[model samples]
Target: MNFYAIKAIYLFEMSRTFRTITQSLLAPVISTILYFVVFGSAIGSKIQTIEGISYGVFIVPGLVMLSVLMQSITNASFAIYFPKFIGTINELLSAPVSTLDIIIGYIGAAATKSFSIGILILLTAHLFVPLNIIHPFYMISFLLLTCFTFCLFGFIIGLWAKNFEQLNLVPMLIITPLVFLGGSFYSISMLPLFWQKLSMFNPVVYLISGFRWTFFNVSDFSFTISLIATISFATLCLIIIFYMFKTSYKIRT
Candidate 1:
């Protein structure tokens, strides 16, 4: 692989993110605040604790995960889309860069953006509410892993998208709904037996469960199970992305 080419692509994409750093950082933070105010103050009283933590505290991981996931998808999608929009994707394909190099360059940029925003939101949360991360390493690791996995998923979305409207459809239509229903605001235990079982089908549930577990040292699913689910989704995303790049699905015509 051409290391120089990879760095060039990665650095260029990173610079693009910096151009809109204010928007990127603030948007998620603001949205997180809205969630906290509405859910924490208004509804938290009605709901009780999960795993010995307040409802507000329990939901933090899910909110953070939602932010990380959305940022990864949008950042990676834009990174891929800019080249197509500016007619540079053809040049990139013709360049000597390997597919792996291209994939890593874009995915790294996406993960970086997501990580930055995730940390910023956490910092913001500290001001309005207190949080505890019992196992710091596990917390950071899971967050980073989720960012990487979703970054790859974003690349696939970028490759599949032909226009700007199509670009946001997946994140808005599919991912957003999944996050809301993924037990971000409420624990699965609060659901009826049937809905509790049904909630298991949503992948984001595992992500939240694992993240919250790191905070309080308690989780609905075992940490091992959560890690396996994350790895599984990531592997599936990698395979799909590889196939898309190999065929140049919407990338090359």
Candidate 2:
């Protein structure tokens, strides 16, 4: 792997992000504020506290996760997809850059963008509700882990997608719906026993619950279980992504 090549790719990607900084960063922040205003202030007043934390505060982790999840996916997908669209991907492929270098370059930028946005959203939430971090280390760890895993998953989506419409399909359709139904705004305890069992199938539930535990020191499920699920899911996603990269699936004939 060439150091110069890696640096070139990273700097180029970062430049592209800078060109549209407002849409990438500020728009997400604005949407997050709207959520705080509408849901936290308007709807939450009618709801009681969860684990001694106000409904608004309880939703903070989920909001952070939402920001990280979307940013990671969109950043990674667009990074690769645009190269393919502009005929630059073939140049990189034919260049001396190894596939590992390519993956690291793209995923690193995506994670960085996602992490920055996640923290920004958390900071923005501070204006609306005072948040308490019962476990700061765990909170940061989960946030990074979530960002890394989704970035890898998005890379796979980028490689597999054949067009712009296909690229946005998974995030807009699958990921968004999963997050909403994953108890981001509500607790599964409010659900009946049957629905509670069903909710377990949604992987985002573990992520949201784990993040909530970091803030309130209370969780719907064991914190250890969430850690294990996150680790396992990330590992599986990495394996699949590595395989795709190694095989050059959908990248070459």
Candidate 3:
């Protein structure tokens, strides 16, 4: 399975993360802490609770999901895009590793980083407000699933991008907005009925809802539906990536 080749690539990516520890790790953690300060401390003191859960506690899962999604995409996309930008991708391509091995290496490393950030954020949240994990198993399951899925999606972005601008385009313009509107800080049920219905079209809502459910046993959609939506999105990303790799899209050109 070319384990050595995969290990080399994996270690290289992980080492890069360590080298840029401030931007790669601390930045997201600090951002999340700020969110807790602004939203949890300032705003939460005014509002009593959302669905009987303290406003601060209610937002924990969403905040974690937000950070995880952004970091996973950023980490994976940059990891591969840098290679393409600097013309080192050809060297990796020339290596004996198969496509699956290469993907496992890069995506695995990115997911690990994002997963670590998610856990760190969760621990950080405990300092601000008490937390009760209704389903610990499901919580970890959702966190791992979200990390791997978004990392794969980011891998696709890396492959499709041609420049630095294009690499940052999707996560900044598209993903950030989705996470904000996806009930990260407030419940979708609190929205106007019309907006609530419209929010259903946003895929990020399902992810946040499902993750929040694991914490509070409450969600905008059924757990089964959220699970299905998440898997469906992951599958779609996989199909798109497969086509790109087969066509050598934005690569070997």
Per-model TM-score versus the true fold = 0.96, 0.96, 0.97
Quote model 2's TM-score. 0.96
Residue-level error in angstroms, candidate 1, position 58: 1.3
Write down the lDDT of every candidate, Cα atoms only. Answer: 0.88, 0.88, 0.91
The residue ranges of model 3 lying beyond 4 angstroms of the native Cα positions read none
Residue by residue across 110-228, what tens digits does model 2's lDDT show? Answer: 88889889999999999899988989999998898888889888988888889999999999999998898888888889889998999999999998999889888888888889999
Query: Residue 185 CA error for candidate 1 (Å)?
Result: 1.1
Model 1, stretches more than 4 Å misplaced? none
Per-residue lDDT over 1-253 for candidate 3, one digit per residue giving the tens place of the 0 to 100 score: 8999889999999999899888877787788889999999999899999999999999999999999999999999998999998889999878887777878899899999999999999989988889999989999998998998999999999998878899999999999999999999999999999999989999999999999999999998998898889888888887887788778888766
Worst 10 residues of 1 by lDDT: 120-129
lDDT tens digits by residue: candidate 1, 1-253: 8888879988998887789888878889899999889998789878888767888887888889989999999999888887898899988999998888988888987898899888888887777778878999999998999999999888888888889999999999999999999988878888999989998998988988898888888777898999999999999989998888788777788
Instruction: Show the colliding residue pairs in model 1.
Output: none
Count backbone clashes in candidate 3: 0
